[model samples]
Target: MLLKKLQLKAIDYKFVLTVCFFLFFAPIVAAQEIIPDVVAEKPAEKPSGGKLKIDGIIATVGDYIVLDSDIDKGFLEITAQGGSIKDITRCQMLGKLLEDKLYAHQAIQDSIIVSDAEVRGMMEERLNYMTQQVGGDINKVVEYYKKSSVEEFKTYFADILKEQKLASEMRDKIVKDVEITPEEVRNFFKKIPKDELPTFGAEMEVAQIVVEPKVSKEDKQKVIDRLNAIRQDVLEGSSFATKAVLYSQDPGSAPNGGYYKMTRKTPFVKEFKDVAFSLQAGEISAPFETNFGFHIIMVDKIKGQEVELRHILISPTVSDAALKEAKERITNIRNKIVGNEISFADAARNESDEKETRANGGTLVNPTTQDTRFELTKMDPVLYSQVSNLKGNEVSQPLLNTDDKGKKTYKLITVTNRIDEHTADYAKDYTKIKELALKEKQINAIAKWFDAKIKDTYIKIIGEYKECAFANNWLKK
Candidate 1:
């Protein structure tokens, strides 16, 4: 029913299509590429004549032409992504395509610049992800996508991705500054029918004090020495990328030869960015330490403000004695808080080793909402297991945790605030209501922009789709 409404309205078809694509085939390609499973499905309808079967242009929107195969491909993609095509007609697919092409066309008219490098970077990342999915075989990826060669596959999808980016940028430009005020939020809430008010789940604000196992001086020196040795090897003509693939401890980049491209504004640790920008092209830096571990970076190229580089990271091993000491330290801290010798907040401020949360009493901000409250139903399974049964203000026992990099730590957690499940209240749920109001405002802005643009733009829906009911005034009636 929801799909049918969206197909009829076409107000936010791109978002619905994106969700369907990502929910099933994300990290493989952008919404543009139809995987083999989708391409293999039979066409939605058999063409009446040989001309229709041979793939002809169905419609033209501004400078773009909609191919007959495009509608077929859209239907196949929907089916492959687990969407039912029973009610989704060819005319609806044409409407969505027309909308997309209109946005891309206006983006060009508005001089929105999506650089070739940006498109290439997106292609490379998708290629890498697809390769990894097929056991690091590029050949398998080409075969899976039914392309003769890797370059052909990338070239075909690059155009699709570029247009997708342009459409996205135009949509963003329409509502980039859309804002809602408190009164607007109140009114938006008031307009909602009483029975339709949303129910918020129980939520908790959690706090923790963490103590990481300290690496001994010898252990630290060993890791630094290892990094220095790797740097020396690279300096003596070893390929840095190959070395990174072989030895880099950073999992996120190791598979891609530790490759990273960043500008001064990239959200890397200050130390990493500082070292990256300080060196000229081809110069390798000495080992530097960040919270993740020790890393040695080599600058590969500098293009304007962006620097392309490779790195190797090495984390010092913690001894058994060090782990035991960390556990004991956290255990003692938990005892003190339990006995009321010191408040958890003060202890966290004074003694917690986790730098990110040590201040502000070790309170955790939910990444999803940028707030302190975490809905219990949506909590991470491991976190839910730890805090689900605890009573009010009850400090949990020291829990051992290990990070992806195999760094071990001990921590104590307590629920600082608990919000029970309830229907939305205007004053209590103002933040959430504000978000809803802002989103609605943005949607309205986009819809208005589309309505006006469709009238001024050259959009001719060829033969069959001319009679289809469209949500927007695409026909300029």
Candidate 2:
């Protein structure tokens, strides 16, 4: 198994902040500059009496000061998520805070800059995730924060977000090239106590040749005609929003009457973005075909590269006859391979409509491992059922597969390999175990860099925090 791209779950505020930066603005961050560190401005609150109690600065890394409130908020967030407020946990959180500031300072010295727009985009994704968790209601979040609007909540978290993006970028810079060899992996696995060894569930390797049913000209015309009729209705004084609510297939924006607030750099599909940007304000586009089917769009307004738009997407219907015909065609191809008329690979290359796999003879590459093997537990449910009981070299009957976008395609499957559930084995589990070794090496590398930086940079800890056992010797001079 190859080391898969890291999948981050919500760990804590710090982890969520950093990882979300990685997830959301990944493409833009790569092309732009390394980014941020600073907490948002504290909104003005009622001042205490003349005998003011200042929130004392708890620690300092370089010239960046960590306030008591910062530590309190960090601790509160973790505890709110069921984490214990132990001394060690507090120490750990403080260490992270110091490290984040160090990264931000270094980023500034290195002249790495993240734009305001990037920060806003990152904040939007975080808010969206929170909104989803609370049942897709933004108002709940707003009420929780006692804010008038979602935008205010974003402003409150803006500085923290900037810092996270910067710190994450800096950390990535440190561990970008770390790798582990086979010997290291083996040694790492050997060190694990036998009782602690991981047991894997059933896994299988499957390959497929897929064929998408061709949309008949009649069906394609039906979609185009429907969109054109809606356009005609709009031209004849019917409200576009009303028609979109009734017929638009884009669920995301359809409920809001197909509205979208988009920037020029918004990550729309290339085909959709091209036509959307070309249209003048108040102009309606003719029916256009994209990968999602057909769409008729209208530009509500334009401000520089930013635009407000409404659209109605109409996906072309796939007739049952067309689906049956596609299944028959694939079924015949599978028959040919089984009858030894042509090899599976030859048939795959000649007949498979899946361009991504056809050239490789229909070998399905596991997205997680980048190998031809798959962990059956992780395989698509629809695909899994077809290959679950097949022995080695056995082909599966024709089955329908639906992609992420709900596009239907038919495929013939072959179970190329399988592994029974078992405890970790050195030879059999080398690839899976290699990831553990690589992660350990990467952690050590980061720790080494951090220790060296602590020595070279100005650092201070209050007497109270100094007593706690910290992973890093922050007090070492």
My TM-score estimates for the predictions, one after another, are: 0.81, 0.63
lDDT at position 362, candidate 2: 88
The reply for model 1, stretches above 4 Å from the true place, is 1-56, 62-65, 68-117, 134-140, 169-173, 236-238, 300-305, 455-458
| Top candidate by TM-score | 1
Return the TM-score for candidate 2, rounded to 2 decimals.
0.63
Global local distance difference test of model 1: 0.78
CA RMSD per model (angstroms) = 4.7, 9.6
State residue 2's C-alpha deviation in candidate 1, in Å: 19
Per-residue alpha-carbon lDDT of model 1 for 323-343, expressed as tens digits?
999999999999899999999
Residue 392 deviation, candidate 1, in Å? 2.8
**In candidate 1, how many Å is residue 327 off?**
1.5
Regions of candidate 2 where Cα sits further than 4 Å from its true position: 1-57, 62-88, 144-149, 179-202, 216-320, 334-346, 376-394, 421-430
Worst 10 residues of 2 by lDDT: 1-10
